[model samples]
Target: MRVVKRINALVLTGLALWLIGTSIAGAAEVNVYSARHYPSDQAIYDQFSKDTGIKVNVVEGDVNGLSQRLQREGTASPADLFITVDAANLQRVKAKDLTQPIESATVNEVVPANLRDADNHWTTISLRARVIAYAIAKVKPDEIKAYEDLADAKWKGKVLARTSNHPYNVGLIASLIAANGPEKTEDWAKAVTGNMARKPQGGDVDQLAALAVGEGAVALTNTYYYARLKGSDKAEDRAIADKVGLIFPNQDGRGVHVNVSGVALTKGSPNKANAIKFIDYLLSPTAQEAMATKGTSEFPVRAGVPQPAGLPALSTLKVDPLPLTKLGELQADAVKLADRAGWR
Candidate 1:
């Protein structure tokens, strides 16, 4: 009876050890909950795995949805990192207390000060500029000199945009607030409303398509969308793309409006080491090269990485000076102002 009891105890001990080992192995692999849905993202993750032998697990979803999920999961969340395209989403995460600050020397070196949170809570990896697009035959290149210029009476009944509530528009409005103050920005928003060719409806691409159909003469769109259309496999898309000329507005003053796809270390990351490694890897030249190449329509945020040919090199455009975090704070005010301005 004594011998049988000893064997049973030994077997139970071995089982517990195996379970602990499995948990540790699982923790070594980073779990990335990302809203970035680009196909090339997988390639970068795969490369990171190949180099470091650390596995990457991804959960792709909308930024708002993922932010809610992280809050619901709380301290028990297995997420090691949260990736998103907009600084506003990162601000949302920060507001939810769902992320922890990264203290990596590598991260500091790779990301520029202007492209990251002041406290290191999140870091931008790539950039996308919202530039003004005009139907080539309808408007001259000098017609729009800046974002503020779009509100001129000449542009009445010619502007196209997404909904006022969209984060993109809100961000732009926020920048306007930072530059020209609430009162002036509101006037600009009102002017934009007066100039709309129709009710503000549709994504950037839709606005571009409307331009092609003569519904509007100018539209606000991201650089990548235009680049994608120019390089699209569809001849129809290419045709519409060719009809519009991209204007890097504010070149003489504030520079173009820029947003980003960035990452934050999730609170209580089970794989902190691997998480930092992955973030650093994203900021590395290797990943930057891949993201800026033919597949992905973004510019690498890291300096010294050669931009892909035909891309608007970051150095060439005048970028707005307001930090992205400020954009988040101004967003609510922008929304309220938009409501008052009758921007639909």
Candidate 2:
């Protein structure tokens, strides 16, 4: 009888220990698939884990790469959250039905209506303006006042840009479509393409470098590239950044075009509850501010947060009232129009 009681006690203790270990293993972990490769983002994740006691598992890669991976994994995808650098990429993920609507009040309150999905599938954490960087020696500040003016004949053989296939360029075209209608935007694209300094071949940073080298007088790119260049430790890079002046085009009309780096919860996330919590944490003021200051040289999507130093204030700029949702919807059409206009 004594031996049997001891055996039973040992069995009960073993079962209790097993349950405890399982609970600890399961405690508050969220898996993230991200296209943003900045060290600052890693810091944000670290802070989030420390504050919430939620462990984060991050898989880093390109936006399209991660999107394809998510599709491949389908319902079995271990991704609890997806993050990427552009609104078009966010739209792509949302279109896959791989992201579910998040009803976090904190998100809704922190992120602006224009920077989030209508169904709340994603929320932009930071904002970057699409501005023109001009070589100060070659171009006068007053010569370029808006995006439309890039098509002016004076700029012919003096414009540098990335490929029209880039999502940033696509989004810019989408914004033009939103502001000026397809007909005018198509005309603008044709005229602008006629003005290309060279075939569109490289990223925004390269475009800026080309401008610095006098290959072109002006380059259309995100503001962050110049900011990064200005902050670069390399002497040549710093010189290139120094020679360029940022122009917030279209301020008199629709203001400058902007895009976002955002996050969403995966549709079939294994840890749905933890994912929601993570999303909430990401949209929190702390996270948004950190991203703006560190990760992308962008403006925080949260209303009251001051934009990072050196960026034009959002309030000062005459932003279009068009919802970003429209931009996402019009992306395919924008690309088609750009292609038709021979925007290489």
The 0-to-1 C-alpha lDDT of every candidate, in the order given, reads 0.88, 0.86
Best by TM-score: 2
**Residue 157 lDDT in model 2?**
98
Q: For candidate 2, lDDT tens digit of each residue in 1-344?
A: 99999999999999999999999878888999999889988898899899988899999998888999999999899998999877778888899889998878888777778889989999887788889899998999999999999999999899999999788999899999988899999999999999998998889999988888889998899988887788777999889888899998877777788888888888898888888888887777788777766666777777776566566667678766677877779989999999999997
Tell me the alpha-carbon RMSD of every candidate.
3.2, 1.9
Reference-based lDDT, residue 117, model 1:
88
Displacement of residue 309 (Cα, Å) in model 2 is: 3.2
- lDDT per residue as tens, model 1, 232-295: 8899989988898889889888888998999999887888989999999998889998888755
Consecutive 10-residue window with the lowest summed lDDT within model 1: 303-312
Off by over 4 Å in 2: 1-8
Give TM per candidate: 0.92, 0.93
Residue pairs with colliding backbones in model 2 are 146-250
**lDDT score, residue 219, model 2?**
87
Off by over 4 Å in 1: 1-27
